[model samples]
Target chain A: MNLLQKFCTRINLTKSSKGYNVSVIALLIILLLIGIFLSISIGSSKISLADIVSAIRLKDQGSNNYRIISFVRIPRTIAAVLVGCALAVSGAILQSVLNNSLASPNVIGVNSGAGLFFILTAAFFPVNIYLSTIAAFIGAILAVFLVYFIARKTGASRMAIVLSGVAVSSFIGAITDTVLTLKPDTMIARAAFLIGGFSGITMDKLSFAGVFILIALIASLVLSYDMNVLALGDESAKSLGLNISRIRFSSLILAAILAGSAISFAGHIGFVGLIVPHVARFIVGHDNRLVIPVSALMGSIFTLLCDLLARVLFAPYEIPVGIIMSFLGGPFFIYLLVKGRRGQLYD
Target chain B: MIKLEDISSGYNKITIIKDINISFNQGTITSIIGKNGCGKTTLLRTASNLLKPFSGKISVADKPITDYSDKELARKVSFLPQLRSVPNITVYNLVMHGRYPYLGFSRTPQKHDKEIVDRAIEEMNLASYVNKNIQELSGGQRQKVYIAMVLAQNSDIIFLDEPTTYLDINHQLEILQIVKRLKQMGKTIIMVLHDLSNALSYSDNICLMEKGQIAIYDSPEGVYKSGKIEEIFNVCSQQLAVADGTKQYVFYIE
Candidate 1:
């Protein structure tokens, strides 16, 4: 009887601790560090942890392991972490602002929007990295605005945003297909860009989007409290002195910047944005104050692990990280939908 | 004190309440009572400044509502609408949000804000449910939690749209008792009520509406004596003296 009581107490402790923000964040941060370490060390040519430490310490510019770490592994690992953080936080903001669990950067046409514009910039412009990032950001903002205006104009219902997003996504997809078919040689690495991998990611390519993601992440954190109030519905938020339109607009813009910058380098990486926020909410409940940071951290861990799997799963030949994400995320999302049928997923 | 002069407003371009002129005295409980589609809610919403009037001016505490910033107006007046989302939140967290107007940009609740929330929770008999998710609460309990949140706002003027709607008999009386307590604390309380007897017996004044205008705004007794309530509601009313020496009103269709 005493052992049963102890076992029940253990279960209760785990349940309650999952809802605590600090502990969850700490655990995720630890997991993220481990993920980063594993991603850097466990490549085709295995570099040990001690070698990684010595590589950083010795600053050996000539050694092969040092060259691999500095040129390839470091940039790839950082790209995965930043992309994860960006998409996850973007999805978190979209979910709260739209008040729909299904809303995500990829689902709502944000990632595809960025992808189309990046491809357009590459085709039309001189393939400037900065210009492509800006174009992608512009596309993301436009897509979100289009989705929002349609949803609002039609009397914003819970499902209206998602429905309009689907419509807009398919329309954009058609345009993208036309562009690709017509200008077949416009983008040389078309499949890699569409499928989203970090194979040729360099420090230069990651630089612009890296800064964009960091700034937007900080802005989301600063406005997280207002986001919490905004989740209380427009009338209540206004009654509590929140400028409803301003907060909502700001959240949308922030989400756009995050998603756009991420897609600029990572291509149309799907499901990380969609799934990470849900996982974060499941851990921390619904406060954006905790949800934003938790989502950002968990996103980095998830993407890092996925990217590592993409690298080592087939050894020598690599698959796009997006494929692995869809493989895992598609089933998980269906499970969420099925479980939510009784109103368990959302409340 | 809140005064609305020549206020005309509605959704989009269509006006629901037109040329409404009314005033709510400080430290008094005023109930706006009317049938469906009679613009009682429109008037309450307009007076609270939730619905921006298309034409006229609304003044709270002798200053134009537009003159005050959103937070400043929130500090002076708090409005609770008929429909509210049941967000997945805890009782404590929901009540703490009432301090939004007073919070700095960081929005971290200070010691004073927590104390205010605690007092409001205690007043609503929600001290025991502070950590519980609001979704787990019953309807009456949820209503009390919302009222507790409003109480935590600590505003001078409070607007409630049908505060007693969907509540049972005992909870209805309980909410009214809390309203009375709020009035006694020197807060101006304005609400829309569907229960004629409760409105008539509890409110200091009753603003009766017909169509899109105020039929009469007078003391409860004066409005009752004027026979406008009976004529407008299409019901017969009798004033009976209760055992406690207070008056009770019963309404029935003749």
Candidate 2:
């Protein structure tokens, strides 16, 4: 047999998965770096490898290439990566903590929560990045808590949580729409925010949300081990001495921080949370320790690639990255359903 | 090793198990047997700290159970809940989670933890299935995997709620054998069992419940002599000698 076949058979023979998991993660990290390079270089302005290197080094700050890379593309690229990492990790955590595969930041009303609050903040308050970020975080928390409490009150089954999330999401979405209808002045900002694109992104907008997302991502890695236990069900988790409520609450808060912060800057970017984690699990199996970091890296790469496609797919007219995401995510989701692996994976 | 006093616990406001007081001795197998909804599961859950008693005091190792942290309590007792999702994890990984309470902040499995997991997998005869996804396993095999996880916990007290439920006769016997071996290892075993004959055959003591109250807590012989099985279950009981030279209680509906 060839070496690849030998390795595949070995993997099936019940060997330690750490070896394969580590290799998979390392490979993804390398791919992510390549993806970032591609995202930076392949924009409408056609910034080359040499230009990106020089721009990042500030070797020729006055050059037009440096100006485009530094001011526009750099901030946009970083925002894509951060937003991707945050949403994907948040979805992974929510899926495990809620023990439902359907649980995602978008599916569970967390994104709409942040979106609603961001809209309200943008309308009433001055355009303060910090205030909007915090408001979005609080809004995400409020929405998640609402969904949780509603589900709990109505029998906290797995389906109940998802059903409650749908109910809460539409309600929050309607509120946001109504707010936009009342204040036509906010439509310009709300339009781009709703579609979710990298156009006009700035370092100032990403700064606060970036910090929150980084801290929340680190916290998620720390808590991933406990999350594995939590996925075993409440009774098993509690029996293993896990504080089920504490872990679940902390996980939700971290997820909120992630989804909330990302949407605070990136707008209601959908499908990254819902799709990337499933893909990550497909690659790395179900260990959250492996799933979380893999999701983070894969999320960054997925968004970066999607953003790249959005930039070049139409030469003069740039579409919102969220539109491209829906175009891809809708088909991928149906593919997962057609594969019939969902039951085997989540059961 | 575990004690409960004036325990009343249930879902929401309604009390299912009321005014129960019982203690489990170490190095023995005690099976809780009762009709459905008689709160046998609740009593087991309450004692294991999975369900908080509405009003009661529980002590473990002569100290209040509340005094111990969750990790400490986990190290003291391992519980196999009746309801659990079949997580999409390999057998080895799932069994390793039994060492959660023993790990430090890093949560990495040390050599000691690995050795225990190895022994547990070996004990459960799960060596061949270590790398297989638990979802791929049969009902009996999955039950073995879960039991291996509990064994890897290595707690002084073990709580299993219907460990043999839904398994075929062969697998059920195998699980009972493991429980027997656990008692031989000097660990306390508390389980809720629906099979009266199996409980009588396997456990040193049987706690019979009726209407959420402990009707009898005694040796299997004593419980059988009390004629409570026939009275409560509306069944006839016969003591027969098996080829193994042990008396087995067989229950049949009249």
Candidate 3:
């Protein structure tokens, strides 16, 4: 066989192999360990790796340093990892459902919808983080339904759905800007949160969002095969006995839940959803069973690295996680676009 | 066996098919041929339960099609629409999806399911391209992969709309042969064919449609002798004799 033939065959064999799952799990574990270490070491204090491990083990040499590492840095790190995983899995699911390369929550307006609701809750309720999270979740769901309804009339064209999402998101964003502009007292605080950061996260809020992300992640993994089947298109899926409407609706809801929960806590971080899944799919192949979990791990690692940079690169007066991610993810996205245009990645 | 009784189906308020009645028997090949906009694809879609009928009933194996759960209906009936763009997927995975009705939450293909998929692939002579991505193959080869997928469903009844679209002459014959082979295996196959000679040669029964209703549904000889072809297709044609009692139509362009 030619080299291309051999490569294609090897990919096909790996996709069908049982050992595929084992290898992915192993990679995920390694990434998790690396992410944990990076999250602990990269902060204002510049703790040593040994000190960080000792602090995690509760065998600290001093109280002040231990408290800083355990209470402050650990929660932020946990929040970053969970939110990263959530966004990545959500992106994978959205791409599969819409069958488009550019169907991430940020691009398709799911995040914008949630962000608008979050802004509303912040403006009106002022002090209820939990209520804001719920409001965001509800808003995300409503936006998805609106997009579905508008696009359904056009026979559910992927391009039409994406365009509708963009239109609706911009409209909602304009409304959010109007509200923020009018409420001068809350404007700066809301803008800071909107810029996306995990710096001020508490253990309670992290744990709260973590539970939702965990459940949604498990649900996404379980439905990964269905998502793969769906990529074959709705007609083929129906012939295979899949309830197309049910699967699409449930998977979209699951993705919205994960993304909405993440945005509620971490604000609207970009690129984790858009870039991580595409990169993970390139590494692991398009079998969602592997792609979903692998993307989650890759997302965690990418976000941890970006968050680390955000904290230490400017030292004290930290950069927003969103800005840092944009710096890294923007170039990666451009590379993907160029490769896709050349027909190297897609073919 | 599949039966459609006075079926009327279409998008919302615009009815495309009007009270159409048709029945297809087990272990036989049937073809529905009609002009553009005559509702052949719509009829097939409704019969396969992809589109719900505005009125009338479709029954599969003595039960209403709508009454059967999605999985239950899939095990009994399979439908392949007209060829469009094939995604970059392997032939093996495409065929394995045919066993999706039997898969549960675990989504693991059983040994028996794998065996069935392999047999279907072998039957289509796609073993060489089994591991090749579908988009890398020729149009005919891709069509065969999809046909193999439907066959792997192992349903008693199968429906295909314009299965020969985009295929070369040789591949068209290859596909017709595979459909014939499926019939020999006791499958009830219903397909839409644009070529009258192919429909007349391969199908045991032919349903010639005009506008939104069936002009005639009977044996090929019966429909040919009824002078309905010229009436329906607006083409002048004569049936020529072939060995083994099969006849071919020669169409004359005015």
| Candidate whose DockQ is highest | 1
Give chain A TM for each model in order: 0.87, 0.88, 0.86
lDDT of 2 by residue, A1-347 (tens): 13432575576732235676676677788989998888888877787898998887889888899988988888989999999999999999988888777778876678789888888888898567568767877888899888878877865655777888899999999999999999877787677667877777889888888898999999999999999998898889888989877887688879988998888877888889988888777666777888899899989998998898899999778888998988987897677657635543344
Where does candidate 3 chain A have its weakest 10-residue lDDT segment?
A338-347
lDDT tens per residue, model 1, A44-138: 99998877887878676789999889889999999999999999999999899889877888656786687788778877884576677678777
Write down the C-alpha DockQ for each prediction: 0.82, 0.81, 0.69
lDDT of 1 by residue, B99-182 (tens): 999998778889999999999999999999988888889888998998898998999999999998898999999989999999
Among the numbered candidates, top lDDT falls to 2
Question: TM-score of chain B, per candidate?
Answer: 0.98, 0.98, 0.97
CAPRI verdict (incorrect, acceptable, medium, high) for model 3: medium
- Cα deviation of B193, candidate 1, in Å: 0.7
Model 3, range A255-343, lDDT digits (tens) per residue?
88888788877877888898888877665557788889888998888898898888888887788888889988998777766755332
Off by over 4 Å in 3: A1-25, A59-62, A149-160, A337-344, B243-245
Candidate 1 backbone collisions, by pair: none
